[model samples]
Target: MIRAATDTGTFVPRIPLGEWVDTAVDWVTATFDPLFDGVKAVFETLYDGLDWALATPPFAVVALVLAALALWVKGWKLGLGTLVGFVVIAGVDQWANAMDTLALVLLATLVALVLGIPLGIWAARDDRVSRVLRPILDFMQTMPAFVYLIPTVVIFLTGPVPGLVATVAFAIAPGVRLTELGIRQVDAEVVEASRAFGATDSRVLRQIQLPLALPTIMAGINQVILLSLSMVVVAGLVGAPGLGAEVVASFQRIDVALGAEAGLSVVLLAIYLDRVSSALAERAPVARALAAAR
Candidate 1:
């Protein structure tokens, strides 16, 4: 008797995910054109204002201001380093590009925080919401940064607007995750004590939970900033002008010196941002008090 053969081939779905996505995107673009246009205008206005302020000032003046900020936040050593780094960037004629990058990063980080913190707070307070958001946050975090640019360009048409939108989306996951974690990590006993003391839910959250969670929240903000900065190159590809554009140009032309200089400028900016944010996180009053008590 002949033995029966079993089917060993893997089954493939007939779903057209790509076409569905395209259709959805087309629907959104058609329906929300005005909203997207408004967003573009607002972002452009903010970017232009920041770029003008940084570029209009004499190089020495802007450098001094940044150095002073570094000194105030981090210390004398970092201040000096910041001053020298900016001077070097200016000397290499990359000051404008650096400033543009800074503007974009700042705007993107702001947008991420605005959207992330509230969502995080909600997630922390509700298990249902948290469960719903977990997969979405995971997808945002795991998706390649370049993947964001496609939909962004389709909707916003390749400019700093799309760049800012993509940067915010790419950078927002850490902000949301850390915010939720921070709030949830607040000591239960402390929370109960506040409740026992006649604290309202809002009061308990505002006075006790948020204060304790400040350091973690700050860390989230720092992560957002770093992620936004990391998107500079991808953003540049879509017409966002910055040091990233210079880096891309250098690559296309194979100008090693230009690439090195642009890369160095980005490094300097990263160092400055990282140090400043770290210092800020450390200096959160609750964080400082906790450290002292420990």
Candidate 2:
């Protein structure tokens, strides 16, 4: 079969992207390796400290306090759920695993918030940046959890911290996108009113825009936690430990009961975090109430 040389011309197969990919890898490694190593070191130190801490009655006390706080903060349902979830996890001998998972999720979510919020502020202020970032955020949100693990494995190796890194990458987009959206959605009238009172741009952002956008930003945080939980499980394939590792091991051994228990533990953890975050987000006031009114 002969085909005319249309717009394709010589029909040169597109140059393999492997070299470009390699170049990117090299650049990233060069730029971020030190930071990455520093992060790994800090995580390792904290993990050891936490593992030691968890070995004591104090850890149990902390858990009890958290359960109580959940009840205090959100209400009886969450508090009771927290207690029940902890009991179930403990009963399955997955309490430590569950805590490990919790730690990773907390750490990842924190990093995501720290990074995402600023990026979001930048996006909100710049139309061009927002336009560019929206699609990237969409891609991060839509990409499968497991797909992120491969590059994570290649670059960071396997374990809780590497898993934490990947979870942050996969889950942070919502925080950035939602924060930007929420900030932009702020009432122009209110903003003008703030300026009428002689507020500077920074003051308006801090006292007006951010306060108003808080609930929405919080909703984004809730989403980040949920997404982190989902990815953290996929991270088990790379030795990320906790319920996820147990789940993976169970599947590998075809131990239905074991896998089910692990899966249940993950679900419990998700529910606990989800409800707590949701409650907080919903409670933010209008001057504080982002999208909560809607």
Clashes of each: 0, 3
**lDDT of candidate 1 over 1-294, digit per residue (tens):** 233344755555566779999999999999999998998899999989988888888889989998999899879999999999998998898998999999899989998999999999999999999999999999999999989999999998877888899999999999999999999999999999989989999999899999999999999999999999999667888888898899889988999999999999999999889999988999899988988999
Per-residue lDDT tens digits of candidate 2, residues 213-258? 8888998999999999988888899999787899899989999999
Candidate 1, residue 190: the lDDT equals 98
Q: Give RMSD to native, each candidate.
A: 3.9, 3.9
Candidate whose TM-score is highest: 1
Deviation in angstroms for 99 in model 1? 0.2
Candidate no. 2 TM-score:
0.87
Q: Candidate 1, after superposition: displacement of residue 291 in Å?
A: 2.4
- After superposing candidate 2, which stretches have Cα over 4 Å from the reference? 1-15, 30-32, 47-60, 287-294
- Tell me the whole-model lDDT of each prediction, alpha carbons only: 0.91, 0.84
TM-score of each: 0.95, 0.87
Clash pairs (backbone) in predicted model 1 = none
